[model samples]
Target: MPRLRYIEESEKTPQARAMIESAHKTGAPDPRVVSIMTRSEIGSAWVELWNKVLYEGVLPHKLKEMCRIQISVAHQCGYCSTVRSNVAKAEGLTEAMIEDLFRYETSPHFTPREKAALRYANLFKQGEQAIDKDEVYRDLAKHFTDEEIIELGQLCAQTDGVGKFVKSLNVISWEEACEINPKLTEARAEAAE
Candidate 1:
């Protein structure tokens, strides 16, 4: 069971319901990663925009997954790291490769591009240190685009966005995130009253 509640199907407004339904629902389409934001379609705007950059963006799944997992770990967020692991698996990354994310520098599973991306993620998450290394940009640019870089930047930023709710709600595991997260039903209950 989750520490929070799952949104009920009926409780969702038609638009919000459709948005969630149409998303990539393999295990859980989009958990918003420990979000307590409204379950209304209003929030779907941000979701859709994200999908546009992620699912529809120029970056391939492998590259995107690499960045996602790397940033999630840099933030020390177990939830995001696990979610990225699953996504990477679906996209063809192996368990070894996923596990290697914590020590990717020495892992042979990563491609040059992937290693470069991971290095970029570490630097990106490291903040001010990024400015100290002008050399980092050359490495990052070989594997990413200005547009793709922007997408990676947003994904990195998500750690903090999701982290706030994750820590506040004490969300530590993906195994029971759905059962614990605030569900559509909960939002409806709140709106109706």
Candidate 2:
């Protein structure tokens, strides 16, 4: 169980309730994610920024998720890794693509552009912000628009922000994502071997 009491579905405000309902229809919303989010309207606000307001506005969902996966790896944030892995699956990213995230340099699953983006995410996290600032932009320009660059950057930042929180909460690794869903654990394990 989480350390704090989350906002139960029964007590969710009308607006949040609607969001929960909507997210459920699209992505198979985990009640725990919603509950924790509702526990703090602030948390819900952050999620809204990602799910509704910012994600599509800033970056292509696939690229954004790819960047997030890279950051989760860089931070050693298993929570972020697992969650984004699920998201990647939902977005039609292949299993090889997901596994390759951890071993991109040696995996053919990553395209050159994809590797560039992942490297950019890793480099940005490593504090060499200026070295490839324009290089990534150039690489991305080949695939996405200027508006997309800003959006992608924002998605990377949000993932890092969430990763930091998940890490601080000691929710770093999940055995079946802390049992948020049993099937996920089983499926993940089956995929592993």
Candidate 3:
């Protein structure tokens, strides 16, 4: 169970209920997180920002989903790592692709552009210094425009920061995830190095 109580369905504001339902239907935001966030005054706006960033930006939803999952797996957030975006699935993102994400630098599943975005996400989660270097932006420029880079950066920042917060909420513990998928712990260890 989540450390935070989810706002009861009947008690939710109409807007909150709608957002939660949308999150469930779409799958990226995860209804559990949305339900918990709905208890806060900022819930609606945060959901809106999440939707716009993940679904409507110039960057492809598949790319953003890959980055989001990469961060989730690296951080060992079971809840976030397990959630899949329906839109991304429709766009041809598969479980196999996600499984190979950690090896993106050398994986045949990812194109040069996808590799660059995943590398950015990995570095972003590691620390500011890892992503702030000149070489990073130059590599990104080869695969993305300035505007696209901005959107990709936003996706990475939100996923990495909020994913940690969600982990702290005890929605799903790292140990619990390891129990469910032993490979996850191994992958996370590989990601840290």
Best candidate, TM-score: 3
lDDT of 1 by residue, 29-65 (tens): 2454313232535455666665554555676766666
- TM-scores of the models, in the given order? 0.69, 0.72, 0.95
Q: Itemize residue pairs with steric clashes in candidate 1.
A: 2-180, 4-180, 5-180, 5-181, 6-183, 7-183, 7-184, 8-184, 8-185
What TM-score does prediction 3 earn? 0.95
* Ten residues in sequence with the least summed lDDT for candidate 1: 184-193
Each candidate: what lDDT?
0.56, 0.60, 0.89
Q: Taking the tens digit of each residue's C-alpha lDDT, what string does model 3 give over 1-193? A: 7889999867799889889989989997989889998888886688889899999979999999999999999888998887889999999999888878888888899999999999999999889999889999999999999999999999998898878888888887788877877778768877878
The better candidate by lDDT, 2 or 3, is: 3
Q: lDDT-based ranking, best first?
A: 3, 2, 1
- Give the clash count for each candidate: 9, 1, 0
For residue 70, model 2's alpha carbon misses the true position, in angstroms, by 2.2
lDDT (0-100) at residue 181 of candidate 2? Answer: 35
Model 2 per-residue lDDT tens digits across residues 1-193: 4544557767888877876775565442234465567667787786677675333564546656767766765665545655643444666777457656656666787777677677666666665454356776777788667776666666667767766776555433555353653444433343233
lDDT of 2: 0.60
Those runs of model 3 whose alpha carbons end farther than 4 Å from true positions after fitting are none
